[model samples]
Target chain A: MNLMMLLEMAADGFGDRVALGPSDGGLTYRDLYDSAGAASVRFRADGGSHVAMADLSSAALPVSLFGAAWAGLPFVPLNYRLTDDELAALASRISPAIIIVDPDSPDRLTGIDGIGLLSRRSLMDLVDGADPPEPEWDMTGEGTAIELFTSGTTGEPKAAVLRHRHLVSYVLGSVEFMGAHEDEAALVSVPPYHVAGIAAILSNVYAGRRVVQLPTFDAHDWVTLVRAESVTSAMVVPTMLTRIVEVLDAEGPDGPGLQTLRSLSYGGGRMPSPTIQRALELLPTTAFVNAYGLTETSSTVALLGPDEHREAMASADPVVRARLGSAGRPLPTIQVTIRDDIGDEVAVGQPGEIWVRGEQVSGEYRGSAPRLTADGWFPTHDGGWMDADGFLHVTGRIDDVIVKGGQNVSPGEIEEVLVCHPAVADAAAIGLPDRQWGERIIAAVVLHPGASASSDELRDAVRDRLRSNRTPDHVEFVGSLPYNDTGKLLRRVLRSDLAHLGDGSTG
Target chain B: MPSLKPGSRFTSSVCTTQVIVVKGAGEVDLRCGGAPMLAAGAAADGGLPAEGASGGTLMGKRYVDQDETVEVLCTKPGDGSLGIGDALLDLKEAKPLPASD
Candidate 1:
């Protein structure tokens, strides 16, 4: 059940194929295998409790990941964007660890106590010169394989533990072995700390797809890499897609100049329907996929396939067209159920907490007991519901749901209506404290370039689409909204930013 | 007859084929090259396969028994074909879902 099993199979099945970087010059499956063996030896000799990387995505990521697995150590990838104090704090938590630092930024984490820092180049040199360790690896699935710190947009980050079995089940269930064509390449821009980033490396390697790494995400750089490397596929967050769509649209209405890209998957946050619509129209040749999952879930537990995307877009039925915003159906290997406040399963089309049960779902965090129930369902505090046809729609977090006059109002619904307006490019609806109602809705709208819309008009638009009660009590025009690096809208930030608008007396 | 479970490795006695059981329960006659497959790393009891048993297996292919109850993923390919009891297993079609990662 070790992650090495996957690499071993890849090395044996397609040892000569290039597994990462440019197809012409990248680490082959054999090269990665040997490097991992070398790394395992180094990790064992260093006697480190864990393998941690505070650097950006690079060739060293995969090597360190597999090496840590072969040596039976947890691989921890810390967010490199954190401040020095925050980064040091996280580093201290995983003390007595081997940390891989970006070679260019040698002084990034100077004087971090109780850690062994190795430059990327130095590690690569050691791997090249060292003897390969034995191929044997512990097969027990109980050992921790990865420790990913959840992106704490709301509060302090928690370390999520992923065991070997959880990860193995995810890969074996979702991905077909050597399913990709020899020429296929997957472009990965997400940071190493993200779950999608780790999943991308494992899935692409097993599928025999070459991986092209992008250290930092710039829409222009992403477009250029796709063109330059002949990248056939990519995974991006909603914000990254919006920017990429903008970049492509600025190229003129002719086409998105991404002929090589066959499939594009977006997740990590709620996608604005307008942006995705424009992208579908612009990249006619590419297949669009909307994947939904969390850090606890190995990766994607539910997905909207390409055909579904086109079908929903073309269908005239309002129900079918609306599914374009849905997260599609759950994966064949996963089960998704909606439950109400008291843990009772809700009726069809009822909004409630999203409870999932799957082998890949490890709802366990470090230092805390697993959140799974006695029977095994993990209550993902995310608010969502399933449609009549079984399509799942995720409405932001449950904690963010506004209780307005004893009615549950999802900010996403109101935000959706506001963004649909031609003048509105982006929007966020938050429930501000109100004396009349428990919470009053406030809309923060970002207009499209050179576009304008009055607060009354925006409220009327919401009233037209939904009930008047759902309309925002107040509307504030803004140039931009706050978002974490991973693209999750910082609703908490918005709550504070607009606190002055409502003080139990106002609104 | 070894009990089969997901992730349990098995080796063919008559050929180079090796497999990991993806599904199955209790004791079952999982065979390769018409000979019972051994738990991974077990010593082979007999020599090469009988003339008709050497049908061949492909790397990265999945083999399933009748009624679709038994499934095994071939981690290594060999000359011997996969089987259960007296029936030869069929190559499972590669149903690839969209790459979501």
Candidate 2:
């Protein structure tokens, strides 16, 4: 039940296969296994209760992750993008930890108490110098494997705890052991702090797929690397996909010549319809997958797979075609239910909070009680509805649902209609205080270059598709929308930025 | 009888067979090589496998009983077959899910 078992199996099954870096000169499964074993000895000697990483994606990430598991310590990856004060606050909470950092910036957490700093290069050197110990990782399966800090847009960040059993179940339920072909390679551009990044490493390794790390994301670099490495698959956030679509479009009709990429999965935010549509048109050979999950869930709980994507795009029926925006069906290993505010199950095609129960669902956070109900369902706070055909459509966060004159308005519904317009490039709908109605809807619009659409035209677009109550009261044309690094829209930031548009009264 | 629970490991006394329980509970006659398997790392009494159960087991494959109540994943290969009492376990077919990270 230890994370080391996966590495041990990989080492035994495919010792000679490349597991990381380039195809010819990368570390093999055996090498990674030995390095993890050696790193565990160093972690144990350091007397740290936890192992933390403050750097980007690299060989050090997998080493530290497995090494901590081998040493029976929790692994925590801190957001390197946080300011010094914010980083210090988080570091203090996980004090008495060994933090891995970039060699160039070793002093990132200089003043933190009881924190041991080890450069990535030095850690690698330790791996190269020391001989690994015999296989002896704890096998209870109850030990914490990872502690991810949620991107707290509303308030302070909370550390989401993932135990070994939860993660191992996720990998086993979703992936087959040694299923990937020897030539398969996956390009990972997400940072180490994200849950997707962690999942990508574990799943790819178990499936025996070679990994190529991209420390920071850039669309042009991503396209070039895919070609150079002959990468067969990739996972990206919505923001990254949008930029890549732009890059591919700029290369003309044939696209960026990415014949090697067979599958491309996008998630971590609400992908604008126009972006996904253009992407499908440009990359005709690639299989598009829309994965949906939260940090609380180990990773993806549901996915809209390749065949469904092509079917949704080609179908003429609006009901089937609209599945292009749906999250598809839940995983066979998980159970999903849409429950109302009173804890009652909603009818099919009805909107409610998404509650899920599964072996991979670890709805526990540090210092907080488990969020699971008596029956074991974890209420996700995400607003969504399941269609009669079983496709799940996610509206934004439940907290962002706008209540206007006793009617509930989903910003995602309005934004979807607005983004369909040819002139609109990106759009976000937010609710502002209004004296007349309980709240007034405001649409923040980003238009394509040199393209223009009047507020009346945009409002009519929503009014035509949906009920008149869903139309925006006002439209604010802006240069761009605010999104976090992981592609989640900063609605709270938007609400505050556009606060002046509403009356000062709380009504 | 050996107790079986998910995540418990077992090894055969006659051959190199090793398995981790994926789905099974309570005590049962979990046998390999026509002999009762012992907990992992337990001493084995030297003897050859029985004539009927010497087919062999493959590494990384899952074996399940006829009623599909018990499932065990082979972590190590062996010269002996795995079974519950008289009925031999069949290799479980892979479901082949789409790759999603």
Candidate 3:
């Protein structure tokens, strides 16, 4: 069905509640509903095939999103961090579009053909002045709701298409209507372009939780906002959580100083063990969730709940404690299977590619055919395994696996062992071409300040934990590793940076 | 009897109750307040709910038939109860999940 149905039900169920911003003078559910209806008239009148936002998160976000759905057009949010040329290139791809920009940079998207520009200020003005039409939206459930461009680490970015039915199914299956209390508020720091950012908006609105926006992420400002707004929950990427934990640790450890934050969820990348362990120790009362999903999956298909976090931390058994690193189990509506390279289902505790099938999984992209198999399972390029207890341990992207002498070696396994060393702050393992072996494993490491570890010592750490073959051929200490804004390690960048090691003359 | 499928909306003739089908298919006699329901947006004749069918429907709640083959989410609350033929729909219990967003 139409995404407008969710907003309509929220408006009808609790029209008077604050849906966004500060509670005292925020936009009410009815106000958001009316603004969406009014904004739809303008979107339809613009004669654009799609509605696009090239700005950060704000009240304008919800208005444009629902308005696009009401007008029966797909909403596209482009990364504002891109260069002018990059931004214009993407805008040209989605021509015949209305791109909403910040008032300060209204000229960001200028000189593009078939593109109408609307400053965020003027959009708000229209929302305030226009009259709402009657409740009417397409209900076929097949219209495109969002087109998100995957962060192109390897090559050109691919536009992933999420239809109304896919997104609505995600919201309906995972979230309850009016489940949140009136006092509950969620702090969102991720940019509008991320899939989690879009999911946060729809899920929070349907749950009747007021949203507090943080346009840019800074650990200190995040802590201040939680205190100022009495925010009850929040979601963050692993990098943001690491910085927040450092900020809390610097304050000295009676507590994290965030009393009202009852739930904190982290995803988008793998969480380092030290960061999560320190966070659990610092904020004992807060519920921590580790959600795992991809842009094609419409957000979280699996999550590790709070109780499991505590149990894993307290349990002395290594098997039970290792659950801390697991992604827990799949949602009841979703089915997850680990399959070998030939598409055969692998046994339990065996590493293979992750395949999922669910109503929420779109697995479709623009300008390409659907990626789903004839049987409806989508092969996620991610490598992972399920433990005996059914906990999913995601190793890393299958493309990043190092093939050494006809054996598949997961970089994540080596990096995890290296990071366990007290001297190592961060680590990354990449495959470099070798004459003797098909590929050689090179470990790029960043050491803690004033702490030192010999290359042999670090190699031994991995060899002790895993097979000797998994140990890195060489350990190169560096200042830091490269990670994207969303915390995904840029392995492609790492490979290019250390290409000299593969040269025989250099050795 | 009207053809039923997911995403179809219906309104009660006797009261203000409205629902969107979340499950079910094929033709069946879907009733509300002891009267046959009409497609959403259709005009309704003003009348009270039947004596035994006035259990009332709550907004944002799911109602399921005995076999659970049919499920509908009430979008508008009213004095009428949802049912099929003479069997009344039961309120589906919620399975609480932790907030992941």
Candidate 4:
């Protein structure tokens, strides 16, 4: 019911083990438990409806998260990248909350009424000096554990509510208690606001894996930290992985390889195939996992494990080779179905909206009705299909599907073919409004550094690989495609900027 | 006796051993040290464990019946083995799942 149960087990099972920060001298499970208890005391005294953090990842992240859980308050991690007005608006919404602020940026959030501000340093100091709170914690499952603001790539950000039971079930179903070896440590660079960040903390703690913090992520710094700390595992967004592959390639053969890293999982956005293929070649020893999940499904609902990656990449069968691009299978705890427009189940290999049902799938947003159906299935709005062998291939968001001449074209399908071309480094396919066709497919192409490709060649490549209808009506080579901080391609931004082009073929 | 359900927490009547049900749902004799386990925070009936029931429990280890019908994860360790009726539960070696996060 309470996430404290998971923490309490960790504290009881491996109290002396380092749970967070630098592996050599980080907070032990006992230290984290005590700090959380101390944090609960401060949070209860603040009389807040929630505990909020506006800073990047640090020791303060876990303390506030567990502390809030212990105190029976919803933990809200707001995006620090938001503008001042946006931050203030979100702060106002979570009024009467203890907002953990960055010490360097005090002026940004000061004078906000009903918001209690605690500097990160002061919060850590409080934990260091204070007595631990009583062990008693609310065990009910109905209380909200974390309220995360969706990235709102499509529209206005909604607060996605994850109850304690949902998270507890997710951790219990996916992770084995005290499963991690003593020397194992995981590097976490994803910002605190990300669902991956929260999931990383909870799963690692329950597995007894030590956490190494990376407050700011640059590929160089991430690679350096991995070597310096002997980090064995890590989770990254697709953008981070692309930069990391570039960094490793620059390191050359003699440079320190990712020898210590046993597992590297990437998600939160679509990963260009070339990057993952290059990464697999660069670090053949490391296991690559393709985790596909949304903010609504706790974290990873489906993951492509390392074995599948190797098999798919090495297999000669076309179907097996295509599995490399698939998200693999749904988790044992999750049930997934591809549904047609009428909400009926689609045939195998047929693309439809991905609907998932499980205890971990919240499908609920604050101030909005739960999105789950009466039977409990949540329409993910992601367009994907199940292969003959049960592998799930996510094409793209349904909203991102380009409807042209009464036919639906998946931008991802075209983007995949474009990226496979040697001259292309990245590609995003979007629909542009057209008078003749309901929507015209326009491809935004980011060529490899110093590489060039003509629109005809790219168009021929798509036309050759897929059907003629799937070919890009117009191809615009660009320096870079727009992506959010988490690596989700800003398709709307691309649509707006290129809207003026208006089926450039006509012009 | 309280019907067992997943996520339900129970405390040993004779020891500090506490557990949460990871699997199981029905009217069944779930016991610790040959004594029925009490609901968490329930008033304990202080007494010594029955003979042959003091084999003990390990912290963080999962115990399951032979048929795997009932499974419990120990939150706290104690000198009293967990059981279903008269059958002592065996230690379940947890298969480590692939780290997805």
Candidate 5:
């Protein structure tokens, strides 16, 4: 079924229960369904398949999305943060009909050829005016629900098709694995235009939970929402979490605060342990999650639960904890395997490329080549391994692996090791050019508040905690690590930054 | 905290704000209709909240995270009693994090 089915079912039982987390005003299920009905009527008569929206996390986006779904059309949510050039490129590629925008974001779209433009304010008025006819339907297969375009860090962004069935499977896995309850309130800070944010939105909605969302993520507003709403759950990234912890550290444990909060799901990138630990200390009652997956995978392939943190810390084996750095075990319905470079299955403990085949995983991209192997597994492009206990650990991007002096070092591995340090708030390791070792290990790190140490002290600290090979050869302090819109670390950016230095730039 | 000077423009009410480097009174005021927006206008008139404003300070509840506190501009009139558009904070200073295991 389409997103329409969800509204239909929700309306019968959960109507007026607050279909979406609050924004502009409380949009009831009746409002949502009726608006979708309006959008559907408009879509069929107008024949607009490509509906592009500029707002990231507004109720307008979702309403239009459901509107498209009811009409059995494809929904493309444009990244409001993208530059005009990027939006222009996407416009050339998709050529959408309805471009819903708002006061917060209005790009140069008035002159664009052959397109219908509606600001969020006017669009709502239109949806209200259109009297919906009977649900005369001609929707497509559940093959692709949202035609998500990749962030295009490595190259140009391409549409990654996510099917409706795939999304339903994903929702099931999240609700089951997360153990979220109905009364639980979720606060979403990540932009809904991204998968992590969408996951946060849909997962909470699917569970029929209350949600409190911030228009955007600001470390300040996030903590305040948690207190005012007593928001028990949230989904955010490491950088934001670090700042929240900093605020909490300066403030006491009991202030304008949360009461019913239970979790803060961390995704969009690997959770730096230092950041997670600091968050644990700050919002102690909130369970922390390290969720891992790609856009093609419908959001979550595996998750490192809060209960496993102790195990991660207690494990003396670097390889074991490195595995702990993994994205997580496949969800209940998923199967994860390690494949050799040639796509052959590797032994359980060996570090091979990670592959996944399951319901939640996409079979193929409509406009692109298939990402699966001959045997039906999706090549995650992530270097990781499946353990004896079936947990999945992610090392780094296979393409991101650095070859230095005949040693294979994934930046994720190096960063994971360094991030465990108490003083280190966040870290990124890269293979820098070296006359001696061809490419030497170099790390750029950020320190936690009220804590500071020299680069040499940090090097020694890692040496004390890890093997000589794994220890960073050089250390330098950085203000912050660069990140894409989705919160994924731009390792290549770090590599380039590291390249722009003298041999003695190591601090 | 020391670096933050007053005069940051606020849209809706915020819970806390730090590093508000507007350097003038004209920071973008976050609003939902008349109040601040929670998500994309979710909580509206309910984004951060009216309580975040205090003494017209922008760094208090309106711009901060939960349980955490900050100083803000009082939304009240300086002449005497609390006035219209006066900033009100949920609390004056930082709050502790949730106690952990």
Candidate 6:
């Protein structure tokens, strides 16, 4: 069942159970359900086939989402961060019958014609005006739970259709995987527009637990809420984790928030070992889980649970290193396999493209197929190997591998070494054009505050540590390296901006 | 502050007396002809176009001017009545607070 169905199945009185609230406050499930029902009815009256909500975080997004579900119309939560032109372009693409904007956005979207706009409060008021009967939407049984868009390879974002069945499956499987219970509440810090954010919200919602959402994440607010809400679980990206660790370390043991959290999750971007090391120190009892998946595969396809993490740490064997640096082992539901370019399964320890298939998988993206084979294994566009133990170890994106100077170089490998350096705060490795090496490796690094390291030192530090051709030929030390909001390093940005090579111009 | 861009920067404190709507998608002519520097919340470095500013109260707070074009469309179509205040204010900054370590 989708989250909406679970909400419907949950005792109506349970709506009184906190459905969602900001980190500082809350809303009853009943109130949420009623508001959604009303929004659904109003949506139908508005002649809206689907409703577009541009909220950052509010009781409104959930109300609209569930309300759209109750009404049998696809509820699209447009990213509120996009430029008007981008939003207009997306609206043109989605062609939603109606549009709802956060009161802070422009009343009418430029470029897009005829789409009506409504403020969130006004939408709620419109619901208040209506008689919010428990909505009885015609059951389609085969519709998607949510439609989220991710940056597409075509240079624009494409919507990924996550079916209700897939979402429900993710919820049930993820809860079991994470050892989450109904009594637990999770703190959601990422942008709701991303799959991780949506997963964090829905998993808690369907399980009927409090989802303490921070409208936007702040290091201070995250700790304060965890302390205040007694939040046992948290989902964070690497960048956010670094900040949380810093504040907690500064606050020391008396820092009330650190002790309360039990299980912490890291995903959407590879968690640097240094960051992970610090995280382990900060939340000693909390099982630092590495959740792995993509937008096409719903939320999580693999999970490296805390127990396995312990095993990886305890083992002195290099063979177990995959578990530590792993994206994760496949979850209970999905079937994962590594296949060579010719579509044949590779033996353990051979790198190949990752493919996944399951009920939790979306067969098509938007209306098209981004990954499909004549025989039907969804290509994950990631290069990795599955060991004899069936654990999957992801290296990086298939295209991210850099073959430079007759030697294969994975930027991720260089990044691994750079992040290990004490002075380096964050690092991203990209390839630069070169006369000698064909494709030269260049590293962009962000130094720790009050720390200073020259390109020569950073480069030599990497060389002395790993005697591979992977040492960066050049180093660009800027105030910061460019990264996507999800905390994944944007090597493309670095690759394009590295024309300066050594001169210190930021823009 | 690794996320901040060099050109456009937002203060941690609030900007503007009324609710602010930063309409930046339109091509702008700057000293440099690339992306305007975003205020630092998520994508201050302009690494990702969708790195939206974090919304919540900044400093004191910015009110939702229900009648404003951006506000009306943002909230609900045709419901010129209520506004979201103090929530997501820091996120609504005119420019992204660029990452500056």
Instruction: List each candidate's DockQ score.
Output: 0.58, 0.60, 0.70, 0.54, 0.01, 0.01
> Model 1: residues >4 Å from true position, as ranges?
A504-507, B1-6, B22-29, B42-46, B50-54, B64-71, B87-94
Q: Per-candidate TM vs. native?
A: 0.95, 0.97, 0.97, 0.95, 0.76, 0.77
lDDT (Cα, tens digit) per residue for candidate 2, span A369-410: 989988789999999999998899998799999999989999
lDDT string for model 4 (B1-101, tens) is 75898778899999889998877898889999889999988987878678999989988788999999998888998888999889999998755567877
* Clash count in backbone of candidate 4: 0
Alpha carbon RMSD to native, model 4: 2.5
lDDT of candidate 4 at residue A19, scale 0 to 100 = 96
Reference-based lDDT, residue B21, model 2: 84
Give one digit per residue, the lDDT tens place, for model 4 in A186-274.
99999989999999999999999999989888999999999999999999998999999999999898878888999999888788899
- Evaluated against the true structure, the overall lDDT of model 3 is 0.91
RMSD of each: 2.2, 1.6, 1.9, 2.5, 19.3, 20.2
TM-score of chain B of 1: 0.89
A217-326: candidate 6 lDDT, tens digit per residue:
78999999888788878888888988888888888777654666777887877778877776776676887778888887877788777867767766888788647878
Q: What TM-scores result for chain A when each predicted structure is judged separately against the true chain A?
A: 0.98, 0.99, 0.98, 0.98, 0.89, 0.91
**Winner of 4 and 5 under DockQ:** 4
CAPRI class of candidate 1: medium
Sum up the clashes in candidate 5: 57
Give the per-residue lDDT of model 5 (tens digit) for A185-232: 777777756776666655655455556768777878887877766677
Minimal lDDT window, size 10, model 6 chain A? A172-181
C-alpha lDDT of all candidate models, in order: 0.90, 0.90, 0.91, 0.90, 0.63, 0.64
Best model number under DockQ: 3
Second chain only: TM-score per model? Answer: 0.89, 0.92, 0.95, 0.91, 0.20, 0.15
lDDT of 1 by residue, A48-132 (tens): 8999998889899999999999999999999988988898888888888989998888787778777888888888999974667
lDDT of 4 at A286: 94
